[model samples]
Target chain A: MEALFFEKLKEILEITDRELSANDKFKEYSEWDSLANLSVIAMIDEEFGVVIDNSEFKNIQTLGELMAEIKKRTK
Target chain B: MLLSTHHNISIKGLAVAVPSGRISVDSFYPSFGEDIVQKFSEMAGVKQITRSIDQQTASDLGYIAAKKLIIEKNIDTNEIGVLVFVSQKPDYRSPATAFVLQHRLGLGKEVICLDINLACSGFVYGLQTTLSLLKNSSKKKALLITADTSNKTLSPEDRTMIMLFGDSGSAVLLEKEDQGNAVFQFGLRSNGYKFKSIITPAGAFRNRDLPNKVEEWADGIKRSDYNTHMKGMDVFGFSITDVPNLIIDFLEATKTETSHYDVVALHQANIYILKQISRKVKIPFEKIPVSIDRYGNNSSNSIPLLLADHFEGKSQVLKILISGFGAGLSWACGSIAMDTKDILPIIITDDIYTQGDFKSSEHD
Candidate 1:
């Protein structure tokens, strides 16, 4: 599940990195913008059936954070 | 700027090029969302809109129009001294569509070819520009071509703009002749503040981004920004608020009244907008020539294309008050006259190309 989460994150970010450090801030990356937010929301909704509201974007700032939220909601 | 001296420019000939694929309101209406199509039908009175196929671009349509005009009128290609192409969709950003058209038509190298990037108000503005060019320069004959392929810039989800536009081109040959069509007196106005009211929010200076940004927008599911976007209410307000005043101003300047015009050819933005403006300006409904019902707004080609369609094979002394408004927050109104008795037979159709496929004639 961790590997799958990173895979999705790499695909979404178009980054070469296979793993994200826990403290990594996704927004600090140059790829993050309104378009990236929408893409991430779509990815989350399609992959995990987890609906991400616009306001909740601040909570899921990193790949680990997003995966944690998804696991919490799915469980 | 006002003209110190008025020069009579003759529309010696006219030709129109429509896409081969045609769709009636029935077939085409379903493609657009039902509500939007219904609203357009109600407003523009367009029962059908002729559209182009993938192989045919806006310049192609212009070329076709010019070809037909030259053929039917038996005018030599070498005689055309100036070529003005009025289009929002040029063949390329660098070389003007007029250059392509001039090459295709075998027009001489001496001919001055240029393109104008105006949309809905294109015909009137083109006329105004052509008149100035003719009067200033020693050019004797000019070809004014107005064409638009709104489908290239529009997405299927953009119901408001999609229903209002059709792909087509028209050509009018203007020559200096005494006792020709009535001297064209124009009232033109543009307000850049409302530029965003109608635009494709990509590919130009304000929206230009790196190649990566374009790729991002392209890959995204939502492609609204690439299509023509108009705050419908704002554009409607602009049209209704400004058009009547502009018409009145033109009438005042020319010292003429509505009764003097045998027909009024206002931009076929939509039926409701036309009717409202007609009511506001106190022009009788019958006096207004509306091709919007059959051909959705053909952008720059709307007025002359409508004139070509309506006046084909008709003989009468017709005084026309034509007005066009859109896109640049631009508005232009003018008056001209023609004896339509000797005009050639012209065909108008509602064939539109969709998703790179030519929909066979639904109207015929």
Candidate 2:
């Protein structure tokens, strides 16, 4: 599930790097923006059928964190 | 400024000549793909557009349009005193296109011929310049010609510009005849700093020797440097923010309201941007005349081309609000009053199939 989530994140955000070291921030990476955020929101809704609020985006700091949240919500 | 306060110059004649090859949005869709073309057409409000595939340069299109005007008006070529050729695309860099056109139209060597390098905001600026020249000079008749051949500059991969632009030209003959079209208040503004925001990266002195560097940016194809490059989101933001303010300033200066004008002809940039402007200014959609669907954005000629098409054979005192906005981050809008009946008939030959009839055509 974690690998699948990482693959999905890589595809959605077009992230090239496969490995992420500890303390790496997703926002600090090049792909983070309002457009990307909206895209991610759309991806979440389409993939998981989970309607995440705009406020929830503030809590997500990394791909791992977003994947965890989606897993929890889906469960 | 010493001229009489209560005087006006009218548009004596207006004519448009487009390329022989016409491509409707329906027929054009297959080249770009149905989904993208449909979205672009819907967004730009362009139903049909004309192009001159056989003609290599935009000057050819301009010459055709000029010829048509001269023939239709039955005016002697010697009568033309001033010729203003407005286009970003000229056949040569140094020699003015106006001169070429002057010779083509058989206008005498004494005629004052010049080129104004502008696009979206060109028609209004050309009009303003021509009017100023006419006011001061002894030139009795002036020809304002706006033409562009964007396809030559475009790449097949360039969906944004390819779907948006069409080759077209318009010739407006200004003479000192009684009961001519009235040129009302005009508002012109530009921000040159944003010029790089919408421009081809190569060509001319900047990238003449550095072919490799240009190839790196434009990906081969020397003509790629000729095509227009626009940052769509930035242009949209600029249009939405600046256009309304300029319109308000124009209204204030002219002492007119939105409801006062009979028809508003906007620079056919895109349907979405125009819609946003209409909403911002609270102008009814029906009040605005749209020709973008049939004719893609024709740079400086969009407004005049539309007017020439709409006013043809229609006998009525028409008060029109004309505005054009585009590259150079420029915009110009104004009002003109004229009798629509003076213009000849305009026919849409290419892409005769109406919208939504795409299913019948295999091109769809």
Over B60-123, each residue of candidate 1 has an lDDT whose tens digit, in order, gives 7877778778888788777678889999887667778788788788898778788888989999
Q: How do the residues B1-364 of candidate 2 rate in per-residue lDDT, one tens digit apiece?
A: 0111113677767777676676677776666678657656655677777776643466666676677778878887777788999998887776898888887788976678999989888998888888777766666788998988776667656666666788877788877655533555678888997888678767778777544222323322223455556665556656665786688778777778999988988888877667767876778989877788778888888887788767677789888877888889788887777778766555322221122122556765
lDDT for each residue of candidate 1 in A23-55, tens digit (9 for 90 to 100) = 678878876753355456656655775655544
Worst 10 residues of 1 chain B by lDDT: B212-221
Q: What TM-score does chain A of each model score against the native chain A?
A: 0.82, 0.72
Each prediction's DockQ?
0.01, 0.04
Off by over 4 Å in 2: A1-75, B1-6, B24-33, B177-183, B212-226, B347-364
Q: What is the lDDT of residue B179 in candidate 2?
A: 55
